[model samples]
Target: MRTRFPLILLLNAAGVALFMSWYLPENHGLWSTLDLAIFHFFNQGLSADNLGYAWFLAIINNRAFDGCALLAMGGLMLSFWLKEDPDGRRRIVVIGLVMLLAAVIINQLAQNLIPVTRSSPSVSVPGVHRVRDFIAFSTKDGSRDSFPGDHGMMLLIFASFMLRYFGRRAFLISLVIFVAFAFPRVMIGAHWFTDIAVGSLTAVLIGVPWVLLTPVSDKLIGLFARNLPHFTKMNRAIK
Candidate 1:
């Protein structure tokens, strides 16, 4: 647990460095290709009449699910504090805070490494009239970037902790929440599909190894176990 926070920080920093050095430069081209692929693959099944509905669902899924995830995490933390011993609660809080701060720093550093560009005026693609318009709208409208989606990353982090403490059910729930939240950034024109893909990958890169290397997760679970009696008492009282 003591070493875990530092390891997460180190891994996130390395990821930022790698993204800046290699990924960011090629993102625009790569994203364009991906966009074309999606359009071609889905265009057959997609009609203008249904496009609005799809977009609406995507936005709702992204924003609403993310809010729910945040609420869930807050509830879990509150429960931990109320049920755990002071020392246990304190340790869990500290670990959570450290991980959050690390994630924020990584996000900021990644953003700085990948410079934001003003939207381009126009773009053209062979055999596709719509591609140019899509590119112009996405880029010129200030929609796409490669710094990673903070909403997605944060939710994933929260889910990781939930999984650590609550097992498979919590893990599966968080996974659903993450996917739901990611859909909005794409639907609402805030991120490219690739942005979500890479953002998720980036979160995993930082989150998984960090959790594995740290004792914080075990500490948190132990705190919950030790305080189960108090929690039961409190729940009974509420009932």
Candidate 2:
């Protein structure tokens, strides 16, 4: 299993590199053309009639952005409350953070390396109307570098971590959540489809195997358990 994890990580990186190979801007015309087509397709189809959808997207995204960390930590605490396996839940929280951190690093590289220049779709698509519950967080400016969608990458990172502990079923559900939240950014003409897709896969390729392959999460979780000895009673009661 030890050796296999590294091999799997390498294979994942190879596959991502293959896809990124075609993601060139002035470098590759065909791939650039495809990306633009998909981007426009998503951006053009958005409508105010889908306000309810926009609300769902906004709420999910808001939770992801504003309170995802709290949710994760809360889940960790809840694991103790529920008397579940401490090691397993601890692994999920720590690894999820690791994946998010790795994605941020990868995002920097992607934005700098293969930066793509493009204009966001017209506001007629889904302008950032100041609705009570809906906040359109699209990049209003037309021409800009929107290569890798950060929010999408973050969502995928979270989802990928959930996939490991829960099962394939959780991954499918997470996929739906990713699309719901991330697609809204594209819908409002903030990002391109490829931006989200490539960014997300980049995260999965780099983050997943790193956590699973190493004892990194174990050490982090152990450190957490050690420093927070105040929770010892809860830990024991749960046991």
Candidate 3:
């Protein structure tokens, strides 16, 4: 079951990419209304003091989250090599590759649903000096057409995996990071409220299946043992 978690994640990610590609831009009215409400809600009492939070949120709403997701994948791969577990490492690498491929395919499909538009000087709302703020505003100008933020999806993916491998603490930390990172996109007009909502949901849809598929520790151990030689060579190269 544990062995299947990565595969499940990949499948779900593919589904989300497909959904976003198929439906978006055409439903801009609904997306705009939702984004406006959420934007105003978060805007209340927001100020420069929470700039750090704003910065993190911006990262999650933008392509920066992609970088973080890739980093997490690298870390997982390194863990397998360090453990000298070839089967384990292979599974992780395979899952990561699948997820990436799905992302590319989905991206291409989504491009047809919503073409990327150039950024204009749009509205400037006070107390929203971040990427999310821009995304929220972009909804009005049609500059922010991406229905779901990929960054949020990746963050959730990382968080879900951490919860499975580590503990509740890791889960909590990842959750906080995910929220923080996602908020800025809405605040700055980079994405609509609906985009964030769907992005987050997309993560859950992918993550739950992954959890169900992955087996517990014992099976993982057996699988690792079976591919020990490959892992050993990889580890030696790392050293």
Candidate 4:
């Protein structure tokens, strides 16, 4: 536990430094340029003539599509749950609960801590195409305060937790899913590139290591396992 202190401090420092590097400049530096470039590259696909492309963005950006992402994450989790023994399954459940609880708490704390209320590219950028404009059905195409993307942060937290509890394979797969699902907002102009790359990611970097690297998460999981309802029948059903 003591050995992890240096690494944890390093990661936390890196996260803070990365955030401050961009924040202090107030989006006028290279980060802003990169944000604009990435935004334009993706937003350009939502042209009036490109109905197919526009529809693709609209479909993925819809609220219903979020369920698909959740299902994908759940499916990955189920794969592990089904393979484990009863004891392992219980542990998995504890970890899952911890991951979820930590994600919610940390996300809320980060939002409050980093209160940079900024608009999405669709609202702030000039002459930009919006997914909502292209689709007949409602879709997310903008945000009043887009800093620190909640969606991407949740995905990142899941991936990070997977790395801590599961193995590298789970981590890699979750990381892929994170990238796959988290970028729709950027593609649709609902979020700037920095919203995910800098904001959400920075929070994850700063926050996740502390919970995952130390004994904190393990102790919490153990507490839950001891106090929460036993899953003997639940385990047998799986068997």
Candidate 5:
């Protein structure tokens, strides 16, 4: 933890630098160009002639499919839960609860504190293919207010927490979950590339390090574990 202080400062500095780089008026063209290129690359697959691809997009963007992403995350956490001893399992539960609290707080801060106000590329960009235009399903293809993406931020927080608590293997799996789940929004044009790459990533870089890299998160988790004896007692049957 002592050695991580420098990294925490570095990450926070990088976050500030990244956000400023995108926010400045002079850099808008460069970032916008990158955003459009990535958006078109993924959204180009939405063609009236490609029913298979349309269906694929529909399934992933559907609200129901979002449940699958949540389930995958839950499954990953449960894998750790099952491997731990009684006290360890209690700590795991406390970690999950702490993670949820942290995610909610961070998301609200990003949404309200950030000055960005941009619509989804699907709605703002001209002459782009839409998923609903091809498929009759009720899938999300655009958003009126798509700035720092909440979905991607949440996934990133989960991945970072995994790395801090669990080993690198868990972190790797969480990374896959982050990409697999977060990319759908970009692929379908519901979010711009910067929304995740610049916006969400920036938020995580600054916010997560302050908690994970310091003793703050561990202290909070320990406090929860101490007070929430019922949760710890439930694991008594395990060993």
Candidate 6:
């Protein structure tokens, strides 16, 4: 576990940097081809009425759903702490929250720094249904929130943390959830492929390593530990 942590951290950092630097941001022929094809395929033979297809897209596009997902994942993450003693559990929780918060903050700020102008298939592609046509929903004034999807960015940060601690099983489950939830926004005309691809990778690289490495995680855990007693006393007082 000790040796593996650094390796994973370095790899994640490298992968994210590479994608951010050259892979996703650049308009390559293959990317455009795949994006166009995937957009058409998802848009076709699907409707908002059933399977919550369009409904799912509309709801999932909102940031609230992302909050719900973080809560759900936080519960799952806290489960790992349940087995540990209070100090150990508190440390892990602190580490996890630090990791999640950092990735989320960085992802949000990076959007402004690495701004990319793109549009959803529904808006850019001819004959594609506008978002409202699929469901009783529309974006804020139909503005494009393109590039490095915030939804994808947020979830991947949480999921990536889970991946390291819980192993392959958790990793695969996180991947499934990511696809199920994050893909719809793009399908329904909220983001481009690169938006998710880049945003998620950025979060994963940042969040996963912070927990996996030492002294850093330890320092964060210690910081939170100092306040837990007061928090516990407050809890007891409330009770």
Ten-residue region with minimum lDDT total, candidate 3 = 134-143
Please provide TM-scores, in order, for all candidate models, with all chains considered together: 0.54, 0.62, 0.47, 0.93, 0.92, 0.74
Q: What is the per-residue lDDT of model 6 for residues 1-239, given as tens digits with 9 covering 90 to 100?
A: 34357666686777567465645545644667777777777667455455466565667666676566666676676677888876667667676767666666667666766546566556677777654765556442134556667777766765665665567776677777778677767776666676677655654565456555545544655677676565556788999
Sort all candidates by TM-score, best to worst: 4, 5, 6, 2, 1, 3
Per-residue lDDT over 53-104 for candidate 5, one digit per residue giving the tens place of the 0 to 100 score: 8788778989998899899989998998998887888788899999999999
Model 3: CA > 4 A from native: 2-34, 40-144, 206-239
- Judge candidate 4 against the unseen true structure and give its global Cα lDDT, from 0 to 1: 0.89
* Backbone clashes under 3 angstroms, per model: 2, 1, 26, 0, 0, 3
True-vs-predicted CA distance for residue 147, candidate 3, Å? 0.8
Clashing pairs in 6: 48-54, 148-195, 149-195
Residue-level lDDT of model 1, residues 44-131, one tens digit each, is 3324445554444343544455566677666666766787876677656665765575557655654555444322111222242222
As a TM-score, model 3 comes out at 0.47
RMSD of 1: 7.7
- CA displacement after TM-score superposition, residue 89 of candidate 4 (Å): 0.8
User: Per-prediction RMSD in angstroms?
Assistant: 7.7, 5.9, 8.4, 2.4, 2.7, 4.1
Write out the backbone clash pairs for model 2: 119-142
Q: Cα lDDT for residue 142, model 2?
A: 30
Lowest lDDT sum, 10 consecutive residues, model 5, at 230-239
Error of 6 at 179 (Å): 2.4
lDDT agreement with native, every candidate: 0.54, 0.56, 0.52, 0.89, 0.89, 0.64
User: What stretches of model 1 exceed 4 Å from their correct place?
Assistant: 2-32, 39-55, 58-66, 75-95, 114-146, 163-169, 203-239
